[model samples]
Target: MKLALFLVLLTLSMSTRAVLDDCTCLVDCKCKKSLRPGQYYCASPDVDTDSQAIRNCNRDTGTVEVPCYAAPNVSCGGLPYNATQCIFTESRPCTFVNGKRYNYYLAVGLSLFLGMLGVDRFYLGYPAIGLMKLCTMGFFLIGHLLDFLLILLQVVGPADQTGYYAPFYGPLVSRVLVNGTDPFIESSSSCTL
Candidate 1:
């Protein structure tokens, strides 16, 4: 019975005399000196903020106050953080794709002079439609009128190899002299006999 009592007392004394070697157990970690926004702090509580002005008054911890943020006191700039706000900035979901440029003059000329021949359709890139139109002569000219309206509205866009309109160019009369292709082939060539 006496030995049991002595061990209990001995344990209590050892715990009370334990070493407090580092600053870890040190409370009231208020900044000794003022620190700028980006500078580093060496002591237990590394960063100081305007919010920390009142010091640690955490009711749960009584008089001990802990720094609001972690060790690094990087420059986050003043109120209303623009950097974080930029993360939710405007987004352009739909983009306008400029299609291949089809020579406007050449396409228009083909539609006007040889609409029934489907030359315009051929120029724009629809070989099958051009052939059908050529064989039937634009359904006795009714389809020709429709094509003219479609062309004006940009519905009959120049075809790319992918068959999509992308940045079509209207043929400049001056550029014709520069590139120089066979007039007959350009004007009247047909995929079929």
Candidate 2:
């Protein structure tokens, strides 16, 4: 019983004399010399507006305080000064195709070159007439001559047939003088204005 009592007394004395080596100091401790004059003191019991201001402050953070008042003179950096609001503009889909019938003059030129052989007429979607022209040697060469005359009239016109010729007569005249392949033969339809 005496030994038990002694052990209990020894344990109590050891615990009482134990050193707290790992204890940490509070950041707002009055002991520090570098503390700011208006530094936030979290442990203070005074809860007021200035303390609330410290709580609401986010200066160190990236958050920005947008001004409630709109400045009339203020302009977006690179945009026009008169432009009030910024809007994204997109292109409307294209609806019109230009010069869809650019190949009509080409067909007329082809008819002149191969009309005697009916090749031109055949390519022009007039197979029956082409066959007849072919069988008759371009109508005993008379039909070929008439076809040439018609093409010529259509091109330059008889000096008096002014309205019969189209505006593209210049290219037709040039093509005739050059007399190359019929460009419109491969096309499904001759282009016309």
* Top-TM-score candidate index: 1
What digit string (tens of lDDT, one per residue) describes model 2 on residues 28-73?
2122233232211112111123212112222233111211111223
Model 1: CA > 4 A from native: 1-100, 161-193
Candidate 1, 1-193: lDDT as tens digits: 6576455444532332222122232111232123332232221221124222122232222122222211222322331312111111111111122234355656777888888999899888899989989999897889998998777556566665212222222222211233544332233222222
**lDDT assessment of candidate 1:** 0.43
Per-candidate local distance difference test: 0.43, 0.38
The local distance difference test score of model 2 is 0.38
Worst 10-residue lDDT window, candidate 1: 86-95
TM-score per candidate: 0.34, 0.28
